[model samples]
Target: MHDRPAPRPQAPPARPPAVRRHNLGLLLGALRAAPSSRATLAAATGLTRGTVAGLLDPLVAAGVLAEGEPDRSRVGRPGTPLVFAGSGPVVLAVSVEVDGVDALVTGLDGQVVHRSRRRRDHRGLDPDAVFGRAARTAANLAARTGRTVAGAGIAVPGPVRGSDGAAVLLRAPNLPRLDGCRPAEHAGALGEVPLLVGNEASLGALAHLGQADDFVYVSADVGIGGGIVVDGRVLPGARGVAGEIGHVVIERAGRLCGCGGTGCVEVYAGLPALLGDAGAADVAALRTAARAGDPAATGALARAGAALGTALTSVLHVVDVGTVVLGGSYAELGTWLVPAVHAELVRRGVATGPDVAVLVSPHGRAATVTGTARAVADRVLGEPDLLLAG
Candidate 1:
């Protein structure tokens, strides 16, 4: 018999590339909220009138907005008024869990649209596996919204190494698996669009900065972390690690830290450190019990607060920010922590001046996710991409 002919391989079916269509709500909102005219947008976005027209006409035809009449009174060419069509673009945002693979989806304007939480065997899970779950979650969310997803931001639990859009570096001891992962590596699964990652605390600070002018944002979670902003810019340190006050050692030689140092503030103030021998879900639950007068919980928060206060006392002396924002789950116990932090400031040879204000972060859990979205918007829009998404 003749030798069997080799089977021919079939070509893969061609799939259309995801067209870059932003939410109509987002575009209309930008036009209405913007202080200037179409010329200003052209100058800001660097896209030609044709591009704007291409983007705007569909929105107008969809009854999302109506084009306003032009005015010829100005010395130069007439200016057309861009008004809102009422409907807007929807954005899906996610706050990726460090302990669990939980994520939250929200609109571009910072509204909670959907939420999901999943338990994973993270023991041997690598970076690719982590991002795979996130990308799939986002795609499902985008499909459900029936609207274009402008972008997605990820709130990671560590420091982002470089300003040139690199992966985040997990500095927390418990998060050893995420040591040097990059966002660029995981963008494919998240849709070949813009993917942004930022420090959890830094993003939380950005969310708080949307309201406050200047403040030090402090977060006490699986690990303690924070971010500093002056006027409206994240103050990244020379080495890309600016607000890592958690690792500052308050009790020298007291307890070992995950970063291989002994007695860092995290050793005393982190949730894991505070709930020694007690199986607690997180610091939030611990703080709640403490407020209910649970002796062990109260004692744990008191000790952690005092250590945090000691750390803040030093930060206050150096930064002297207008306000100190306490966020994260533990922030519910601000009443107990503030006084101790104030006392430590006094003991540190710094005067309790009248200028400093201690306030809880009003934005709460949504900060990090929002901040990461802001970073992605900055990449897409040719703007300064400041602390706020708007």
Candidate 2:
């Protein structure tokens, strides 16, 4: 019988595309957290050595990962470290605030390769013009880096529809030009790259994911907004507005907000409201005044901190997070702001349970910009096929 046909071998089991994708993400995420050898990665990811090797081939080929020097410190055979490639894919991040726009080219490891800032009065600037400026800045950054641009992320001062990057600014009193404007319409210099538009505070919160598993990020710029992280994930809510803590009503008879609502936290805690003829041109000046015992500045910050505490109390009641991160301009005021906020929370009794801790963001005002780039880079890392396709 032809020597029994030599017992034909059976083909190995096939893994579905989704399973492969999931495994890829797991490996990439492990490397992102820290560089590791193949054996260590396999153990951490619960994938076999051979399976991890198989998954790493494509990533290495795509320049998403690089094999580092072998570890001679280990016994017997040495293991090479797998790390994010220095020349890996990058993302363009654009942050549009009330005053101006910032563009940055960031690597997968969240390092800013190139950065540019344009300070222009955006009060009545045309929305298209705003995007154009951002696009030009991004183009310049890309030209300087000469790396693959995986995608683009935009952090806007106003609300953005989560569905299709539509600007849902009912009325951005601070940034009226963005009102009724669709930023996605004009891709500007970014061209056909994938675009993601989100609230500045929402994206800013992502920068702190590595800092804590759960925390509330409050961004105090020209306006006040927040981002809530619950159990290591951002809570964008049903309409993607979960972290709009700025609009949470803190005072029943407070001043009118740009959203046409009364007593909104922003109406009291916003930069303009807090300044209120304090004779301080900017947050730095205001901080100096507060440090020098200017009652007006100190009083303004105290009231703002109280309003933040009120909104955050409601946030903690719902999300039960233990940490609140002061970001943006608030970070500059943390010396006094954190104390005032903590006092208010203590007064309201929300600071007792979980032992609430208020901290200043290491990224400071750059949190939103850094987080925006990180958000886009994360997507690219999750689905490296995008880079391969490009």
Candidate 3:
């Protein structure tokens, strides 16, 4: 205290964090709806034009937002339309599966600029080794992109406990044993950056949101997983263990599930399980066989559909989700599966009203990765905390 000079007359009080956050929200909202003028942005965000301008300055400097060409033809006053830089810091999204891991390096706009997949012996592999490989793959991709990776998001093929961010491999089918593994343990090798671990289904749900909430997304990938959103927020059930539809027991003392249960829905509906019984290489072949009136394939689809319907009935009973979206490789079978699911729901009379809908997911293989990238982007842009206040 004695050596230091007077605090330089104390700079004026800075703006409140709320004010900054509000302005930032406006900026991000505007950028998302790009090629918009200040007037349009103000109107869209209900912020004053001056405030929008002030916010845009810092964002522009940071390469998050950029000024578009001036609009000179309008009669009243010329305004510069705003556009996103689209080349800001990147977010690497990785999916850890039983047989291999898939990673996508995406830009700020949730576009996959680069992607790579690596195969490994998923069985008997240590959790640390798997995570290290994923982190290294992400780093190598980021280096190749020559862009600053702001963060990394990992989607595991199991129930990721929301409470502790640990990979809960207990109830998943075909996933490697990772009982007490946490994705955060691998963040250190990923540059100690902000890392996000989420269930692939939830991420897929977020991606299909496409900016809307209040939808239920069912992912029919290697296994069946689901994501439920209420009023625009994906609900993380207590312990981040929500949406374990795969383990919903459909039959008693029927086909045994890998999870030590008899006739779990995932046992029949999961592609791998069905493929094992059908002797088909993939779901597409199975679907083809089913469509061609192959008795076994048809019976399998019917069984899978009934189980899916029963499971969906449970979801509909608990959460009054308005829209049910089907996605992933098996979504191609939506033509058959959706009707069966709907029939079961109707037969069971789960919905009191006629508002519920079952639609195909708007995205395909890229859904989970894109959704994770969007999460990272929203976090960086200082979005309102959905968990705390949304």
Identify the runs in model 2 with alpha carbons over 4 angstroms from their true place: 1-11, 163-171, 277-281
Look at candidate 1 and tell me the lDDT of residue 359. 73
Alpha-carbon runs more than 4 Å astray in model 3: 1-15, 70-78, 163-177, 249-263, 272-281, 351-354, 383-390
* Per-residue C-alpha lDDT of model 1 across residues 1-390, encoded as one tens digit per residue: 111222333553432333223332234346634533555554556654544555566545654345566656666666665664334344455555665544555443445566665665544567677667766776676667665555666766777766433656645345567677775576466664456667778766877755676888888777788998886667767664789888887878678877778878888877677777233466567666767888777666667777877888778778877677888755666776766665555666554555566677665566666665544543443321211132
Residue 135's C-alpha lDDT in candidate 1?
Answer: 66
Alpha-carbon lDDT, every model:
0.62, 0.79, 0.71
| CA RMSD of all predictions | 13.8, 5.2, 7.4
Higher TM-score: candidate 2 or 3?
A: 2
What lDDT, from 0 to 1, does candidate 3 have? 0.71
**lDDT leader:** 2
TM-score of each: 0.69, 0.90, 0.83
Over 1-390, each residue of candidate 3 has an lDDT whose tens digit, in order, gives: 011112332444577979878777756755674577766776778865666666566667776556788778766556677776666677788877777777888766666789887787666767777778877887788788877677778887777775223444343345455655776675456865667778888876878766457877788876778888875567777665577677777777878876677877888778777677666678778888978888877766666677787888887888877777888865777877777777777778875435667787767776777776666666655643321121
Candidate 3 lowest-lDDT run of ten: 1-10
Better of 1 and 2 by lDDT: 2
What stretches of model 1 exceed 4 Å from their correct place?
1-92, 101-121, 163-165, 168-172, 277-289, 292-300, 346-354, 362-364, 378-390
Global CA lDDT of candidate 1, please? Answer: 0.62
